[model samples]
Target: MAFFRQLVGKILKNFNDRLSVSAAAALAFAVFCVLKAKGKPKFPFVNLSNFMLVLQKKLVEEVIFDGSHILFRCVNQAQWHVTQAEPMIRGKELFKSLVQYRCQFK
Candidate 1:
């Protein structure tokens, strides 16, 4: 149809003029962020138990650690300092004791 053709032409013309994916512009924005923000120091971790203990200690108040992760939280607070810190934070003793309890026969 003539109406459809005209509508499609107008839409494609606008898109061609407006759309952009400039690497230089993206690189400039990234550089601004790197210059503006100071990042946190990374922690050396071997296992979940040690990681969880350190994270719990950093919180403003006590936080309950589920076997695999932290529970629902409050508004002013966040659980872990780092995104990858969760699975690494499990309590070794608690987990060991749980496993023993499950395996032992009465």
Candidate 2:
């Protein structure tokens, strides 16, 4: 009976240790997420409508295309950047539209 009790106690101790370790890991992850969310500004997705608005409002002053990233300076003096994950065709379409819009204004 004593041996059985000892075995059960050891099992419970091991389970408790694992539970504490898991809880600590979860807490750390939650803290990291909170920090990340607080630091980042949420920008609107880059699409046709947004691009049109940028053009219509003359919000974008300069646009820089670097490989998979597009960086632009707004009239408000704020700079915004986006990394494109879409296919090359979509990027080409966006570039064409931007050029068309700029040509119209000029």
Top model number, lDDT: 2
- Give lDDT for model 1: 0.45
User: Runs in model 1 with CA error above 4 Å?
Assistant: 1-21, 39-59, 62-76, 79-106
List the candidate 2 regions with Cα displacement exceeding 4 Å. 1-48, 83-85, 88-97, 102-106
Cα lDDT of model 2 overall? 0.62
Error of 1 at 65 (Å): 23
TM agreement with the true structure for every prediction: 0.21, 0.38
Residue 13, model 1, lDDT:
53
Pairs with steric clashes in candidate 2: none
For candidate 1, write residues 45-76 as lDDT tens digits. 23445444443444224334455544323236
